[model samples]
Target: MTVVAPPTLAPPPPPGAYKDPKASAVASRAWRWLWLPLLILVLVIAGASVVFIVDLDSSDTGTLNPHSYRPDGGNALRVLTEQYGTPVDTPSTSADALKAGLGGDVTLLIPDTAPLSVRTIQSLKALPPSTRVVLLAPDRGALHVLFPDLDFGDFPATSPVAPNCDAPEAKAAGSIDFDGAGYLPKTIHAAHVTSCYQGGLLLVSDSTGPEFALLGDANLLTNEHLTGYGHAALGINLLSTHSRVEWLYLDQPESASSEGGDGSQALFPPWVDAASLYLILAGVLVALWQARRLGVPVPEPLPVVVRSAETVEGRARLYRRAGARKLAAESLRGGALARITPALGLGADPDPRALIIALAQRSGRTTQEIHRLLYSPPPTDDQGLLALATELDRLVDDYLTQLTIGRAGADQGNNPEGPQQ
Candidate 1:
């Protein structure tokens, strides 16, 4: 008798507590397999990044590089020069260019003059008088250092202009594409300067010095422009004058000190830029994917509820504040007509005469009074508008009441019990 069972203490389970074991197992299996697709996506992104970095570093590509096959490169011009029976030599440094230029009768072509150092400029000044030096879009400082008698006066003309000078090269080339800086001779030495294409091309020569030719636009020699308007003839004429040509393709400015010359002065490797660009693009794609919604938007109930009477009163207040009495009267008249017309069994666009007659016969009001209430001119003042609204409400109420009474009388006549004796 003392070993009685203890009462059960757990509560009963809620309704629908059971779930499909098969479905639960399927969900768990799907979650476990999600990592396969995730791993594949990560591997694809990493592989693409590696390929992009490898491709970017695989070639020596630049704007004016003679070996670059890009549109803005000088590879086409270089090929054309070779085809025209002139030997072309690409010098990597200022020393190499100076040595090549001084070795024999060679034409030195400098596409960019920003990296030229003072020592290089001095060395160029000491070259033989027979050597021809071509400068593409040189700035004022370089021109001052190399030729003190000439400088850039104004912006160069970008449109095609006829060669207005008597130079044999300009006459042969005719109208060359002009998109470079213009040159002007110093007042004292204006006689020594020979200009063409409105000063877009200049030639400076003295009896005891090397000849200097300044081309205002460097795009004239680019592969993209070489085939356009007299560009091929102009480029060939300038660079192919001598049997040998030396092109100075300097990527960076020469360091003045010998201590920092061993390593490059760039802040980061070239692949870093490509990698950063790819990472930014990947981040954008991930953000867009994660932010995508699954289906059409679901409408939610408004947080606050507003009553119809309050809304009408608010609109009335606004109309009164704006002094729109005529508009208020028109709205009141229109609402009354719409309700009364439907009750009178009239069509949507009933004849105006028939509508007036129906309202007049039902409400015992004159046809003119019904017409005035329904279709009169709008009110001019607030008092007139209020009067119009009150009249309209009275008219609609009378018409509906008369209609109900008529229906009730007709029903009583047809009833067998005879008027609820």
Candidate 2:
């Protein structure tokens, strides 16, 4: 018995059949290698974020930090004082200042009052009558104890103002930088206070008792503004009046441990505990609700089927939107060549020159023109790409038509139609 082979409709798809993409791509060694760098990048970013947050609360690195020479630092002022023979001593806490200043001859300069504990405030008020206390604008919290008769109010900007009264420091400094803390003297004790800079009482001095001096703002002493107005001279004269200077810089907020306290309840704010309880109750409710519906997962085939052609179109649209005409033209040329190769009886992976020659002979086109169409450098713009695509489609169609006609003629010649035999 004799058997005839079926007519070839299309070529086999480039060796391997359509394979489902590996679902375990993430588990593959190549993917594992790619993820290592990404994981490292994420860890690096997280570490940087934590460092940035910690740096935000630092005082030694900030403008007002005595040791820092940065634009905002008090390094210039510190150097100036040391030049005048009275070196600035930085004490970590209020207790350290009190211990050093107990000699009465030592001057205590509290640059910031944010970290002052309840005990520190009380101890400062009862310092030796001989010790002088210079405080840079104490916040509203410390104002009650430090300035018993002063009311905290808006601090408005003021032009260079002279010391109108007999206060020697004010008069000697002559037109000083007075844009500082505003104080409203409310009681009989505050009547003796010397005020300056409009509403801002830049200095409040009491010479009879433990002398206390209040500055309006700390900016006057920073490196950026130290040379402006009479800031440098005033800051130097004010800090150097004593034999020794103790610059008390409070770094952190008053801790519960320092107050002799323990446990989260005492350490953290009350609202934090209440919020945590609500969150825990919500999580428990969600868990209980989900537990009722939990069961063995049922296996099912995918309901929707997406064709590779749809993916190709989507990628093409993206390339078009991004103006990636060169890449798009190359893809169009590759696809056209892939289909044209089989239609011309040239097997897969045929040499480009040979394929062009064969296509030219069958389609009655020049070899150079065919070569340019298939393997030319990518088109410059979208318009050129569109024209190239049209040419490629026409070439493929012409070649396919020629192939069909040639095959029909060969078939007829092979089996000749003889007279009725």
Cα lDDT of model 2 by residue, 231-274, tens digit? 88777877888888898776577653453233336768879978
**Backbone clash total, candidate 2:** 4
Whole-structure CA lDDT of model 1: 0.76
How far in Å is the alpha carbon of 334 misplaced in model 2?
47
Per-residue lDDT of 210 in model 2: 59
How do the predictions measure up, each by TM-score?
Answer: 0.48, 0.47
In model 2, what is the error at residue 263, expressed in angstroms?
A: 14
| lDDT of each residue in 1-421, candidate 1, tens digit only | 1222222223322333422223444675687789799899999999999999997775557667888888888999999989999989997777778777776578999888888776677677777877889888887778878777665657654567788888888888889768767877553263367888878888877755667888888888898889899988888888877878899887678754312233343646778879989999999999999989789889999789989999999999999999977567667866887788787777776666667767777886776676667665667888888888899889888888777777776676688486555
Using lDDT as the measure, the top candidate is 1
* Poorest 10 consecutive residues by lDDT, candidate 2: 15-24
**Candidate 1 ranges beyond 4 A from true positions:** 1-58, 156-158, 186-191, 257-421
